[model samples]
Target: MRSPLRTLVPLALWLLCLPALAQDYVPSRDAWSHASPSEAGFDPARLAAAVDWARANGEQAPADLRDALMASFGPREPDYRILGPVGTRGPANGMILRGGRIVAEWGDTARPEMTFSVAKSTLSVVAGLAYDDGLLPEPDQRVSMQVSGPWFEGAHNGAITWTHLLHQTSDWSGALWDIHDWADRPDGDDPANRVLHAPGTHYKYNDVRVNLLALALLELQREPAPQVFKRRVMDPIGASSTWRWEGYENSWITLDGLRMQSVSGGGHFGGGMVINTRDLARLGLLMQRDGEWNGQRLLSSDWIARALVPSRVKSDYGYLWWLNTGRTAIPAAPERAFWAAGFGGNHVYIDREHDLVIVTRWTPDLAGVVTRVLEALEQP
Candidate 1:
């Protein structure tokens, strides 16, 4: 007959080791779990300085933002444009999470706003989900085999692989969502209508090509990309319901008799991810956790590892995510840290080494903000 306290102790230890019980912080569906900087191993005074710095460097759309863009680019790519004048911007705001607990936030972190190129990272994850589901054969598999006749039927486009598309090295030339690949950000002095490099050998950040990848994903999933992300990624990770990914005005495509709009990769021509900073922080947290939330694995750590591996062509870029190889992307941040960066200073940064996640929207000084924020942590 064991002592009553001894028997109870074993049961208590078992409960403590369970995954859900092991978690120190997990949010309710509608709200985040909060923690003080000191509680989360951050220097309270230094964290305050970081928050104050954000207040002084928040983002606002310039009255001449469009005028400046049009002036610089000569003319708008009408087909790629999202239609109408720009919407009023939300405040320059963000949230910081340490060990999945909210450490601090500034601005209106709940208000949704355009997140530009960060949408590309969202697209990258969707691609991961498809690959995980076996809908895609492999990174090297030719997309032509999956997509039917028309765009990918020709030799130049048919040569493109899923890896090529993910790396932005496909150099797949095409007019998608009505904008020609060569015309989106045409090289002024050396414009090449035809793709000069073979597929997988060159890199180009063409929004049209990104849209093409979206279409390909939509086809591969046999459903909308949003549906896949919602069912597989967001719902499990406890992300907010206020997020939306938008496509261009004319990006609709008919697949299997159902018409679907292909979402844009960025807010460049307009119409991309519109998400609040809190939700953005949630996403960063998930990635920081290697696509796990609480006890469940939303994505395999293997996929996350492969996705962050630098492309052969672009050392500073991973699958739609910006890597800090050689500390080029963020000089102050660790080389292992990576970010999903967007125009207007929108960003979702992940640093597993420091167990930190950061989301910044409408921020102006990315490098300056990152440098100051990283200073709050007790260095390893």
Candidate 2:
């Protein structure tokens, strides 16, 4: 017969877990519940001030993104021009989620807007899905093993790996969609003859190389990445159909008798994700919860852990996701906090320690907005 102490011990443990279990929440497709600032452990006035401050500090870029792109890169890069589609944008907007419920919001949170480099984070998630399905056995696996193109050929590019691509250290040379790799934020005036570092030896932020990764993943999965992301991630998380993933007009390729367009990793050349703040918040919530939605496991926890590990060359970056490692990036935020950032001041911040997901669009100062939100939290 079991002793009375055994029964009491189990009951006490269950009681201890009750609070945590109650705090966990996942919004459904049709409805999203809301919690007042005070109810969500925030000072109501302070949270409101933060939202107001963010709205006033919208991006300084031109409303016409094509003009903005040209003004930003045309002067620096030789022959730099938009090769993909660009469009006008909406006003500043965003939402704040505490414990999976909205605590405060402002602007047109439902309006879809171009989220430039933030799409790289979405690409990272799609890669994580490929990893889960055994399509990619190891991050260190050489890209040449799976991809049958000249993209990974030659001694320098031949040595590149999936890890190198994800960390932005591949230093892959060449052009895709007629845009040369050296033309992207080139170092020296002579970009065409710029020095090439061995793969994995140096870190460089290059959109052309990122697009190569998208193409490689397309080859491995033999399907469009957006489809994989929708079926495995977005749909399970109850994301609406408003979000879109796009690539350059010339980025199309023929794979196994099917013509498929490879997606871009950012909007530097004018193609990436255009998504609403609410759906963007949902992605953040999924990352905050370790890729688990409700009771379903979407991405393996192992993949997320690997993705968050800081790269050797860049301590503040991890698998396309930006980090606040050592509190260097955002002093007010926790070191474990990570985010997906885009041009035109779009960002989705996931604060795991505080159970917070803050989405801000067209807000120039992300750190300032985040600091304001952190200050509003009521101390336990």
Candidate 3:
């Protein structure tokens, strides 16, 4: 007995809610295992044409660079296999850009894939945008001023601020435990969570602090974090691809919810953001360009400078980014280069002076693949 428009509205909402319905259709591995490239969206004729254009435009690499680069291709890197166990079972893809043009690219760089904690770097950008747009309260503002919920009352949480959260110096303890334990607790107001050290005095990679930051952003914006991201950051940069912020399974929880599952538009805490390699490259390029893209300044140069400056925790910890002090195996040239690295060998290495950005998406390795990649980057 419902009106026709009313009936259609529910049906539309139901269709929108279905996961498979909204996703881009991709061929299953089994279906394309034996198929030709033409059958897999890479038509032979088109590919040949593209190759001809490349040759005509002199886009082919120099003989020596080609050989050196190709040597690292395929599944032959035993050290990488050992270092990244989860990564070897799948494709390892990467892209390299110099002077705003792709110099070398390999593997399936266009596919939507997981980037683990690389999401944190993206979250940092979001915070910068929020600050620029006036959505976020001032960075020095006390946490107690913004969030009045039971979590910040009369404890170290009250003393926390956006600056402290960004630097991983919120002084909160009991955050080192696995995420599942925190998710299962019912009382959001537990006093056992106290300051282990004064804010800005120490550094610990605490997921809870970042998760709380995500919550604060959501509360300030009054919308899901991803939408805010799209409007302020991603779309402005011309990345139109769909990405997701994964969460725990069942029962939609806050960004900090324990049992969340991977959802399309969610918060930016621990389990958020699944983007394709191409978009990831775009993001790196944006950062490398000092927040400018296609002739527009998305973020102020001053802001980027501040974000890349090291914090008190480490000589390398920036606003959420990681600066390379040449301490890691990766000999970051010019010593001004920085990176946003994640578990399982995901990395976005940005060198502003060199006008270079390198993005790698690889399986988790047990061997020293990370060290080898760093060595490769240091190549003369």
Best candidate according to lDDT: 2
How far residue 255's Cα lies from its native spot in candidate 1, in Å, is: 2.2
RMSD of each: 7.1, 5.1, 17.4
Model 1 poorest 10 in a row by lDDT? 78-87
Cand. 3 TM to true fold:
0.64
Give candidate 2 regions above 4 Å deviation.
Answer: 1-21
lDDT of 2 by residue, 15-45 (tens): 3443432446899998988888887778999
lDDT of 1 by residue, 93-158 (tens): 888877688889887888877777899999999998987888885888899888775778677788
lDDT against true structure, model 1: 0.78
* Model 3 Cα lDDT, one tens digit per residue, 69-100: 23432233212111110111135666655444
The worst-scoring run of ten residues by lDDT in candidate 2 lies at: 14-23
Cα deviation in Å at residue 104, candidate 2?
A: 0.7
lDDT of model number 3: 0.55
The TM-score values for the models, in the order shown, are: 0.88, 0.94, 0.64
* Residue 28 displacement in candidate 1 (angstroms): 2.1
Instruction: Provide the lDDT at 75 for model 2.
Output: 93
Per-model clash counts, in order, read: 0, 0, 23
Q: CA lDDT of each candidate? A: 0.78, 0.90, 0.55
